[model samples]
Target chain A: MEIRKKRRICLVVAYDGTNYQGWQIQQNGNTIEAELNRALSALTKEPIEVSGASRTDSGVHARCNYAVFDTAVRMPGDKFSYALNQRLPEDIRVRKSYEVSPDWHPRKCSSKKTYEYRIFNDEFPDPLCRLYTHFTYTKLDTDRMNTAAGYLIGEHDFKSFCSIHTQTETTVRTITDLSVKKEGSLITIRVTGTGFLYNMVRIIAGTLIEVGNGKYPPEHIKEILQHCDRSCAGPTAPARGLTLVEYEFL
Target chain B: MEIRKKRRICLVVAYDGTNYQGWQIQQNGNTIEAELNRALSALTKEPIEVSGASRTDSGVHARCNYAVFDTAVRMPGDKFSYALNQRLPEDIRVRKSYEVSPDWHPRKCSSKKTYEYRIFNDEFPDPLCRLYTHFTYTKLDTDRMNTAAGYLIGEHDFKSFCSIHTQTETTVRTITDLSVKKEGSLITIRVTGTGFLYNMVRIIAGTLIEVGNGKYPPEHIKEILQHCDRSCAGPTAPARGLTLVEYEFL
Candidate 1:
């Protein structure tokens, strides 16, 4: 009897996420993973299920998300991106694909993730930029936001910055960098971390925005982190403004 | 009988232009003018007709498209922007509105117009930027493009760059400035002129792109302009990349 060896393939995906429920499969709505699975199943002539590195929430965009699946198909790994893209919607694209060790698991690997939250600080909303950015009529002070973001770096308990619905065993994470930059009427909050709990990035963005708007001082971030309570933080920023921009596995 | 003098209201309008036919009143399709007329009629309680300064082609965007309409409504001129925005679609917005002299006409006045054509030169198309920018996989030489563009500055007969279907009797126009700038994978062609013939900016962009791609030499623009024939220039670029960025009356 001949045994066919299945190879593990990792794909780097990019999606608009405007019309998708999320990166994960859900019963009620369409998702990036569901479309990917359907396309993979059709291409490989096998029922394929992929494991996503991050299960981003609905309306959250990603420039580079990671996913892996095992397949017995004879097609070249790099060719998967082209083949899958032909069947996928325009909003979702497979940026690249490569072969990985069969034993490699996405969640088990140590990785660095980067997210960017965009804010359009203008008197009126820009119709062209409304989809990807959060609109705020009030002016924002980037210097204050950057000062507030300084306290978030390094290892700390991020429970206050995480959604209460998260089921993570531990809430401690190491933030490598956090920056607030303003250009014209656009403000961007970029954060890089070892790992994040559910809604961590959005919550942090909301807190920083409050600091920028003078509702909270720059020092308030310390108090919020020390409280270790979700209620101590500001409201969660909208998902539309946040984008997963990078995923680097070590 | 009390004579209610009709006042001319000039609007500075902005629109995404992705869904509209153009800035003119079209019989078979929706347009920016049609929407403005509808909103004005509802707001003023009287029939309103507007004349547009530029009848932009389908898929072209505008940051400031000028339009003038006469109405008997007593509402403050600046308040029209707020009132019309409430009734208009999300894709279109009235940036500002003010009362103009009854004799003032948008097209008759001497004005300088600025148009920008954006090209996303990358390995693959970015879905998020698809609506506002034209995507090209070929590498573009900005130096060559800028050199070609330089020949277009100053007054000249733009017959070679004008569309054959234009109804204008004269193709002579004065170009104040023409520049090609590149940032990362994005290339922008910005042109400011006293007046433009139909499809003039788009044709110039296409011709400059050809020069950037090595299809034509930098010195070819001088010969093309001297030819005084439409066929001497490159094809007209797509309307999606063109935007009316500014309109300033002298």
Candidate 2:
């Protein structure tokens, strides 16, 4: 008797995330994960399920994300990106694919994740940029936002910046870097960390926005972190403005 | 007799243009002009007709297109922007509105118009930028594109760049400036001119793209111009990539 060992394939995925639910499968609506599973099943002539690294919220885009699936088909793993792209919608795409160790799982490994929140700080919204940018009428001071962000650069309990519905065991996380940058009426909040709680980046973005608009001083971030209460944080910004820009396994 | 004289209101209009049939009032499709007229007539209980400075093609965006309409509504001119924005769709916006001379038609006076064509030179299309950029896998040489654009800067009978079906009597036009700039994966071809023929900017963008991709030498632009035939130029690039960025009356 001969035994055939299944091979694991990993994909670098990018999606606009405007039309579907987030990366996880759900009952009420379609999602990026479901779309990928459907495309993979149709292509490989089997029911294939993929494990995703991040379950981003609906309307939150991703420039670089990871997903893994096991298959017993004889096709080359690198060719899966081209094959899957033909079946997937234009809003979602598989950037690259390669074979990985069969025992490796995407979400179980230690990884660094980066997100960017874009704000169009102008008198009026530029219609062409409405989909990708959050519009704010008041001018933002990036210097103040940067100073506030600098206080969140080390290890701390991020419960204040997390959603109350989050089921994570611990809210303590290490933020490796945080910065606010501005150019030509556009403000960007970029955050990188080893891991994040649900809505942590968005709450941080909203809090920094408050600092930039003079609602709160730079030192307010320290107090919010000390409180470690979700009510102490600012609002979670619109999901449309957040994007998972980078993900890498350590 | 009490008289209420109609005032001319000029608008700085911006639109995504991805979902509308350009700026003209076409019978078979929804248009920016039709939407503006609908919003205006509904806001003020009167029929309104507008004169547009540029009738951009379908899928072509505009950041600063001008439109003027006469109205007897007692609403203040500057407040029109705010009022109309509430009635218009999210994809179209009135950036500014002010009173203009009663006879100051948007198209009759000499004006300098600037258009930019964006190309995303990358290995794969970024879904976030797909609506605003033309994706090309081939790397572009901006230096070569700039050199080619320099030849088209002065006055020239741009017959080779105009569309074959253009109804204009003559193709003579003055190009004020032309340059190619690159930032990261985005390449911008900005051209300013006194006037443009039908599809002139798109043809020029296509020709420059060919020059950048090594299909033609930089000096080939002069020969193409002197030929005085539409077939001498490259194909008309996609309308989605072109944007009317600036318009100013001389």
Candidate 3:
């Protein structure tokens, strides 16, 4: 008998993480990855272990995310999205799916990731968007927040911006872009980078918020980066408003 | 002894209707209106009975909904939004609250109401958006759908579009505007009217969908309207994706 060839597939997924622990495999009941695997296994009639490009934290949202899985089922690879989405939960969907080389690893591929943080600056919370955004008070200086974010766009030792408990050996990462804009009572902070340290985006948001509120000078970010001391960074913002927008393979 | 006058309050509320039985006060386990009343009553230390502009069906969303109530509480009406929102569930919120004319009736006021219907026109369902949108197959013709919607505009006896179980005494209503557009795989249908018959928007969408799929000609809508028979209309579309975008008071 001939050996079965493994077919690799790429996926674009969107999720509301309020109910999930995170994307990784865990002993607990709910996980985006576990749900995906279960859905895929049911669809493909086999055990399909998938690997996600980023292990996004719980309470995060994603408009588009990438994941890869290998399956030896009889179905064509192009039809995988339709098949998998049918079995998945409504809040997490496979936007699209495609065939890729078996060696294409979702994590190892060279690319950039984009994340967005939303702040509801209004005095009252928007109940409809409560689960999808963060609410905050205390006036923020847009100019100062913008100025502080400028210091983050480039290669740097991001140790100060990451959680002290980050498991990665090196906290060095290249930030490609950062921006802050306000629309009505909503302030949006967007960041794109080659990679990120643990809790980096949320920490950056919190630090920038301090600059906006005049609690910290815009130039303070440079010092925080130079010191590489976790204590120098601002507190971690809440996780509700963080969204993993996308990952691009280039 | 002098009697303190009662204050009439108006509120702009928003909610995620996934778990509740819609906006009305129901004898069932929970309702958005009941929850808001509970929170408001608890905060003001008074019995409160709030009336909503629309009794939205279960699973329907509202971005800006109006409600009015009479109370002799001591709290300032402007701050009612802040106070009510603090105690409301994470899924329901009061965006703004202010004192209104004692005669102001949320449902009686003649205003343009805007409603939007969303359909996921993809081959597969999105797990993340499952609870928030409706999924349908068969390619849709947006231009044709828009053309058909034109027949719904203007004053008419809309008895055929109203559900048989509607409690309203009159089925005559005016549909000021109707439009349909497709953004990628998402088809959004927006309707503006002085008022809608019971289940009217969903029925209109369902009937238009038939036209989009070529099962019925655009002109067929005119015939259905003329017949004045609910059976002549298409099936009522799902309630999940419909949203009360706003109400204009002039």
Q: Best by DockQ, which number?
A: 2
**What digit string (tens of lDDT, one per residue) describes model 3 on residues A1-250?**
9778888888888888888888888897598899999999898888988899888888788878888988887677678777777787677878788888989887887889999998887766765567777887777878889999999999999999989887897889999999999998789999999999999999999999889888999999999999999899999998888999868877
Better of 1 and 2 by TM-score: 2
User: Candidate 1's residue-wise lDDT over B1-250, tens digit each?
Assistant: 9879899999988888989899889889999999999998998888888899999999999989999999888889999998998998878888889999999998998999999999989876666677788878899999999999999999999999999988887889999999999998899999999999999999999999999999999999999999999999998999889999999999
Residues B147-169 of candidate 2: C-alpha lDDT, one tens digit per residue: 99999998999999999987888
lDDT of each: 0.92, 0.93, 0.87
TM, every model:
0.94, 0.97, 0.92
Which has the better lDDT: candidate 1, or candidate 3?
Answer: 1
Candidate 1 residue spans exceeding 4 A from truth: A1-4, B1-3
> Which is superior by DockQ, 1 or 2?
2
lDDT of 1 at B15: 89
Better of 2 and 3 by TM-score: 2
Cα error of candidate 1 at position A39, Å = 3.1
Model 3 interface RMSD over true interface Cα atoms: 2.4
* Range of the 10 consecutive residues with the lowest summed lDDT in candidate 2 chain A: A1-10
* Each candidate's clash count: 0, 0, 9
Candidate 1 CAPRI assessment class:
medium
